[model samples]
Target: MDVEDDNSYETSTLQVLELKTGDSLRDAIGLLYEKNVFGAPIADVIDSATTSGNFLDPYIGFIDFATMVLWSLEIGELAKSFLWDPFFPVHLNDTLFHVLLLLSKHRIQFVPVIEQFSSKVIAFVTQNAVIQLLLQSSGLEWFDSIADKPLSEFRFENDEHAVHLYGDQSIAEAMHILWENRIGAVAVVRRETERLIGCVTRSDLHLLLDNDDIFNNRKSLTVEKFIHLEASKVHSDPTIEGDLGALLSAGILTLKNKFLPRMDSPVTNRRTDTLKQTMKNLAETNCSSSFIVDELQRLKGVVTLRDMIVQFAPPCMDSRINGGGFFDSALEQTGCHIEKGTLVSDH
Candidate 1:
């Protein structure tokens, strides 16, 4: 597409959630959860002393939902903490290329769009939004053409390895692993076989919001017990008391309970699979990454959306090296394929 000339695409108004400096972190997190967003722009608190009195004039930073969770756990009170600072925001006049560069360089999910002087957040752009636009406009065939490449080429060995959790591991341990690795999810493997059973994610931890006691006692309880209790409570059709009874009957109340049932089926792909197929799976499932497996179903590597973006960047750079002629060629290719009867002409 003619990204530069088509300013219309870049200037479209986008409605986004904005967080104030003084807003409670818990309330902000709740708003994110309710809206199913990962983060929001953090606007500066209004300064009453200022003569302009423009509330949107200063944006300090952005707060990620995951960061909020970590802070909440640390302070023991979400209300005590304020939004984190030093966030990156994109300018309204910036081209899509600039946004792509920002997303790829920072490895962030979304970036806020702000006006030049006002610093007011007009909208936000997400990796998903950009990918969707590319797919709809250019189709996936080009991406699919590159899919036959092995995933190993894209794997980052210097980054932390995939951390797995045992069913009997404590929730505190799981949280620590997540925090240390700075990852949102981890594989839950069978203790004896080391085989993947299920997966646990930050969202799964949302179950803790339902019970203050459980949230408080997270350290003592095993993941197995927590999963069972959550499942029984959420899935059971009986009364709340009956659900508690079921939880007790399932032998999950005691710390000695060793039952470790799977929570959610793991999303995985073999290392032998083509990148094209993997990308297709990721798009269709709307997952951030897929576990790379070996012939024996052993966990080997991980292919994340960031990795894919990194891989695709070089080719895009190559296309742009010709001083914007690639878009003209693409447009020519598209025009040549138009049907005879569909052509419009001035009579």
Candidate 2:
């Protein structure tokens, strides 16, 4: 039941996307691309095709575009199937600050909000959603103290070296960098002036699935050409091969429309912009990350959704033992396979 009070939130019904074990790499990518979602849970396969669980426990693990792209770029042709990563999940009783810490530390998109009694996942609260809740606190003293501060006032560890590529660089090369660096997007700059010209994000890579023309001519296509294609496409010289798998596959859910989630135009910020202001821009643009640039439009640093969420957490020392960044290393240390993704626990 929903609380009618203006301050309370309700655990309402939701339609969550699910990836199956049988979904090929391309199939999963196309699903995410089609849905315009960053990540989703893999549906559990069992004797009966009915949904099962504590409250509604039918999912095994979760996966996202960033990890999927990384896998496609490196671990090709293993028939390697993937699924659930045991990530930090939240209970109804858990405090917001606790959830914020887990999100900031794990750098995850959504934290599973499970029922306290049956442990069924009732919600997958997203970073953007949480940020929206915080934005509601704009007038509060505690929130204002942090939001009013400029970007320079906050600490950005390892932010100076944002991954980037030149306009002349091939789209293939950009994909390789995204795979190698474990990043979602890269800045495209003019080689001569090093000015921010455009941005090539993980979302842009979906062109390979949506447009057979792009997959056919990926080699000769430059980053600049790729960005241009987003606006008005011109196919490259036809080649023998086309897209890897059937771009359109029957998934648990149907695809929406062919609309790109992220755009080539770089949503940016400056050193002087306050946290409150930057958050507004990010929300307005529906962008996960923003490039901080100088007066000359040269890239200075980048601010991400994770960067914003972490800012709200109470000040503390880095507690990670092995420089815990992404879950890749953690999985390796535990000998976990692609199917058995990693999950973090606050305990």
| Best-matching candidate per TM-score | 2
Pull out the clashing pairs in model 2.
Answer: 52-57, 53-57, 61-84, 85-341, 86-343, 87-343
Which prediction has the highest lDDT against the true structure? 2
Quickly count the clashes in candidate 1: 1
Q: Provide C-alpha RMSD values for all models, in order.
A: 12.1, 11.2
Q: List the residue pairs that clash in candidate 1.
A: 147-276
Worst 10 residues of 2 by lDDT: 240-249
True lDDT of residue 339, candidate 2: 29
Per-residue lDDT tens digits of candidate 2, residues 1-347? 12112122333356556677677778887778877766777755554556455445556677776568657666765245653465577677677777677777775666766666755555565655556567779988767877898988876753566788899988778888887886767899889999998888765665676688877676678888788665553222112111101111111112231321334567788989988888766654445678889999998888887788877663223333222222333444566424223343423
- Candidate 2: segments with Cα more than 4 A from true spot: 1-14, 21-27, 30-37, 43-58, 81-86, 91-93, 115-122, 232-262, 314-347
Assess the local accuracy of residue 239 in candidate 1 as a C-alpha lDDT between 0 and 100: 38
